[model samples]
Target: MADNSKARVRRLMPEDAAPYREIRLEALKLSSEAFGSSFEQEGSQPLDYFRETLAKTDVFGAFVEADLVGVAGFRRQAGTKQAHKGYLWGMYVRPVARGTGAGKSLVKAVLDHARERVELVQLAVVSDNEAAQRLYRSCGFVAYGHEVHSLKQGGRYYDELLMAVALTLPST
Candidate 1:
């Protein structure tokens, strides 16, 4: 949140795929403990991989003075198992842009999409990632349970807290 009034948010375009991938891989690399995958696992994914992901998902980016500073993505839960829900993923705000409402804006953009279009939004945050957990909670998410050793990399296990926000409330 460098300057709240200076940030602009828009749907991520095909042209943004490359820069998006670069920053995303950087986040995974630098904060693997807070994420499910390692940098090595996703760093090698080509720009085309991101292009394909963008093609299939609802993605948005926050720009500050024309520089991409934050990104968040929404994807539908697949199959008959959970088709009514959407998954929120790939959320990141540049270190300098955090805590200035840019993160809040990015989250609101995701929730805005889900509320009118999808029934539920689900996300997983690493147990020790307190900052992210606080952000999500402040944005209206509620945790149901913890998935122990939910993800493993580099010979260590990381726990995940499962969270969800209901986009539509039940009618009285």
Candidate 2:
């Protein structure tokens, strides 16, 4: 659905496994350092796995006409002590759609979903990924810490900047 010439971000349905998997595998392959999951690990997963995940998590896809252009995922923490927290993950925008507002729309949709169910939302970005970090900051997420050796690839480690945003104002 187009809204005033803007691509609309919609939550993926179980039948969207094909397009979702296509974009996800592409993201993992094109920007391995930006995601925690490897292309090999996710690529081997069956179509049913994608469908199951779509059913479980609040994953949203940005579509330009009938083609899927971008995707992001959100999940709330489980368990009593941590149930108030949620996370934003797997954020990726197709290179062609980078400057077309798909990335920002995906993030804003995730934050809007998170605000409904959790008090805080968290996400981590590769330490040197300045563009992604800047996007998150513009959405009101602030860095709280940095984790060293967060992910390793080919014997090299990458640091991650941990960030979070409070969905609700502090109680007085």
Candidate 3:
């Protein structure tokens, strides 16, 4: 595995939606238990959906030598009562990019984006995914609760651990 220190992390633009869709499908197919959406469901969506999502959500990508290798997404809660919160969603690092700084860089990018507009950023991890749990914890996320049977794939139920990180404004 390549070390992630050299990876370039940046916010993805609308033009990058195609590659983002490709990698997202790859993630859903290979790591079904880790995400709430299924490959079948997302694959059937129109290209416009992906483009619109990319244009609106705070999605970040990690590139290694011009090849996109990882992705993370953040979106602020959309309501008057929930405006202070955001969600950390659709996090994935390509197998080849694992252990490289890609995962951490993507997370840092998401949290940095979240801090700009929300006071808390929340996410969920498959209860059994230790590596991902560790990654979130390392990013300062802490477990707050568990959602039993949060997702069902192939008739199997998967539990998800809810986690969140409080964002503090930088002191002037």
Q: Could you arrange the candidates by TM-score from highest to lowest?
A: 3, 2, 1
Where's the lowest-lDDT run of ten residues in candidate 3? 1-10
Pick by lDDT: 2 or 3, better one: 2
Task: Give each model's whole-structure lDDT.
Answer: 0.82, 0.90, 0.90
The per-residue C-alpha lDDT of model 1 at residue 4 equals 56
State every prediction's TM-score relative to the real structure. Answer: 0.88, 0.93, 0.93
Number of the top-ranking candidate, with lDDT as the measure: 2
Point out the higher-scoring one by TM-score: 1 or 2: 2
**Displacement of the residue 77 alpha carbon in candidate 3, Å:** 1.0
TM-score for model 3?
0.93
| Tens digit of per-residue lDDT, candidate 1, span 6-69 | 5687778777888889778877877777766668877887888888877777888888887888
The alpha-carbon lDDT assigned to residue 132 of candidate 3 equals 92
Off by over 4 Å in 2: 1-5, 169-172
Task: Give the runs in model 1 whose Cα sits over 4 Å from its true position.
Answer: 1-5, 169-172
Alpha-carbon deviation at 13 in model 3, angstroms: 0.9
> In terms of lDDT, which candidate is stronger, 1 or 3?
3
lDDT of 2 at 123: 97
How far is 137's C-alpha from truth in model 2 (Å)? 0.6
